[model samples]
Target: MPESELGGPEEKSYTAPGKVPLDSGWVDVPRLSLSASAGPGAFGGEERPFDNFRFSQRWLREQGLDGSHLSAITVEGDSMEPLLRAGDEVLVDHSPQPFRDGIHVVRLEDTLLVKRVAAQGGGRYSLLSQNLAYPPLEVNAQDIEIVGRVVWKSGRL
Candidate 1:
């Protein structure tokens, strides 16, 4: 049998089987301990990173987003279903952005939530949900704090 036909010593695998090799093309974004409620709401406690999610550096630059201003949080309900489901990890950009219509993570009182934010004029905004069962929450500029904008999500199909 020829050495080329059989597996040779030069063809050794550096990475173990069933393990994903770390790629330099990707960047690790911290996954925070917080959970953004997609339904009612979840308490915004434990502002610390528990893990990390790998993201493409090129894609971040293409989106005009800064990785240092990004964090990941898990979605906690089905209120934003069809778009963002329960247990989905969402990438939130903490960078300053023009408060326009889009999915955002907001701090409403003591709770943290993920919802579609719409400008209502005169410094007021409405938090809308993808699920029709949940009604939109109208909030004033003083009553809510925009944590960041949801830029990406990783979930099952």
Candidate 2:
């Protein structure tokens, strides 16, 4: 057998078997310790990165996500059910752009929440839930801080 065909000294494995190599065109985004509530829950006063999730760089670019501004947070309720479920991990973009009417993660009174926000045309937003059991929450735009926009979500089937 030739040297190239054999387990040659020049060839080295950068990662374990069945794992993606570091230079394999994948990027890691931090999974934050914060949880975005779909119901009523308060977040502890710590913003730490717990772990990282690997995603294809090409795919992220296609989705128009900036890797530097991307982070993941876990969902903690069923208010956005059928679209976002409890324990679902969602990708957030922290870019400071004009807010559009869409699903977003917001911080209100120290609680982080994920809800569909509709522009009420008077510096007010209506927070809506997919589950009809929860009523829509209306708030003045100045009260809540928009943490980020939910760009993607993943959950176990």
Which prediction has the highest lDDT against the true structure? 1
How many clashing residue pairs, candidate 1? 0
Per-model TM against the reference: 0.83, 0.84
Error of 2 at 157 (Å): 1.6
Task: State the C-alpha lDDT per candidate.
Answer: 0.88, 0.85
The collision pairs in model 1 are none
After superposing candidate 1, which stretches have Cα over 4 Å from the reference? 1-23
Q: Tens digit of lDDT per residue, candidate 2, span 30-113?
A: 998889989775583567888888899899999988788999999998999978999999999998898898999999888999
Candidate 1, residue 57: CA error in Å? 1.6
- Residue 76's C-alpha lDDT in candidate 2? 91
Show how many residue pairs clash in every candidate, following the order shown.
Answer: 0, 0
State the lDDT at 95 in candidate 1: 88
